[model samples]
Target: MMKATPESMTDADGLEMDRCFSTRGGVAYVGLRDRWPWYTKRRSASWPFAELRVADDKIVISSMFGKYAVTRDDVASISRFGRIPALYDGFKFVIRGDYEAVVFWALWGPPVRAAFVRHGWEIVG
Candidate 1:
């Protein structure tokens, strides 16, 4: 369980490094997230869809519904998981909120995971 140190800082890349990711320019990573009614509210499962990025000390998740932001200070930990649905490999970002955000692994997963680890966030496999 690693933690962010006082000296740790994001480089010129903002949050996730766009150049290092498989995602298009200006985005850190691309992954699936809760859509529309969201997974928790549905009787049948809907496919996850979203984009992940870091900006101004907040982790931002952008979806068709809009964007959700979690401050870096609010994050408790990030853990890797593979549950339900085929290829559901994802990570859960636990924060000081009533809900936690789930990011499904994509072509962007590996590099972003490495980036988060490098960022000194508490990342558990």
Candidate 2:
């Protein structure tokens, strides 16, 4: 497993954001992208940032609260949560084991969706 360091972390634009994690009340979060502004306001919680990275054969999410990595073999399906252009079009990642599903929210889901597809992961929805 490769860990993200300040010199290695980059944003969607390929530029270094310097900060690799988001923290609130002592907990940190890392994912593809943090929650949308509207979603964050509605949720009433500050910490939902997720840092998603695709490894050799797995998807890794690192967060201050918890970290999990799901390999291609453990993935059951990847589906779209809602129609495009909605408030937030999110993607759902369902794992085959006892792990719970993970959903990533954003106005645009194609970028990350493409990343998963490129890794030969299955998309059921």
Candidate 3:
């Protein structure tokens, strides 16, 4: 699940502004782009947070573990999955390389598509 800091950052429509609007990468970033969402394994383990940033010629994924760069040559394959039957659908991707990294997000399709397109990554799935 997505958690927010200070717990009162929703928009007027009661939507989560922090989660829905924050952009870690791309050219035209808008909304509450201040906070990065934190991902935890359980309730006790250390949180692993990731941010996508567009470098001069590559897209970078920086996280608690390490950093990975996705170039134009890298292939991005996407898959949809969820723990619940239909309530928590999310997307996951694997970038193939020696330093391959998998990223998951609860974001909808369009934004995810736009991110890949903007970075010139080839979407294979």
By lDDT, who's the top model here? 2
Clashes of 3: 0
Tens-digit per-residue lDDT, 2-119, candidate 2:
8988777775534345522222211122222343531111121122455566544656555544555567677776677545573455556666754345555644456656766666
Clash pairs of candidate 2?
Answer: 28-64, 30-50, 30-51, 31-50, 31-51, 31-52, 32-52
Question: Each model's RMSD to truth, in Å?
Answer: 10.2, 10.5, 14.6
Instruction: Tell me how many clashing residue pairs each candidate has.
Output: 1, 7, 0
Q: Candidate 1 residues 1-125, lDDT tens each? A: 98855345444334544322223111122232357543241111123456666443556655555555667777766677553344444666655654535453544356666756665555688
Worst 10-residue lDDT window for candidate 3 reads: 25-34
Task: Please report how far candidate 1 places residue 98 from its true position, in Å.
Answer: 1.2
Which candidate's TM-score is highest?
2
List candidate 3 segments past 4 Å from native: 1-48, 73-100
* Candidate 1 clash pair list: 33-49
